[model samples]
Target: EPEVTQTPSHQVTQMGQEVILRCVPISNHLYFYWYRQILGQKVEFLVSFYNNEISEKSEIFDDQFSVERPDGSNFTLKIRSTKLEDSAMYFCASSVGRSSYEQYFGPGTRLTVT
Candidate 1:
């Protein structure tokens, strides 16, 4: 079975620098989403994308953040300017459909901002 994969399992960046996290979900899946978990905090939904546009987003997804699918298989999240609060483990997930489907989560990319 195909599963989601992410690159650079861990990322370290300086505060105020731009960072891009990459993910490749199962080839056959249609819906994609992003979630983040700060150390010692609960997992929070960041955004969901479908058909090349954002379907839903949380307040955490502000002007400083963006998501894109540069290619058919790769979905990426970019932070225009990193803050200490942005440091967390970002997870990429996908499912066959958005409603009542089980989401498969990637191993996650840990972002450490100083």
Candidate 2:
């Protein structure tokens, strides 16, 4: 199994704005990723595009957010404009199987609807 970590377990935001959470995943993993959870909802894979070109991404991965494979170990997603619905649990995850495809999730997305 892989290791994962997320920052600011909880976050509060206004009606319209932007927020970027952070995560640190297993050091030896190959694939890095992000996901989100709408309170009391199922976990959704926002994006899974890899190798710096987005191998895959969800419809939710709209213009509002952009992701980057900045380096060998860090992957980041930035949101340009955040609406009240943007509030959700943001999770960072990692996987070793480029083919096996098993993902381990960080704490989670808890974006409050304000």
Could you say which candidate leads in lDDT? 1
lDDT string for model 2 (1-114, tens) is: 456877668777766667766666677666777888777888888877455677778899998888776666666677766788887889988887677777877886466646
- lDDT by candidate, in order shown: 0.96, 0.74
Off by over 4 Å in 2: none
Number of clashes in every candidate structure? 0, 10
lDDT of 1 by residue, 1-114 (tens): 789999779999999999999999999899999999999999999999999999999999999999999999999999999999999999999999978999999999999999
Query: Model 2, residue 95: displacement in angstroms?
Result: 0.3
- In terms of lDDT, the poorest run of 10 residues in model 2 is 105-114
RMSD of each: 0.5, 2.1
Residue 2 in model 1: lDDT: 89
Candidate 1: where are CA atoms >4 Å away? none
Reference-based TM-score, model 2: 0.82
Best by TM-score: 1
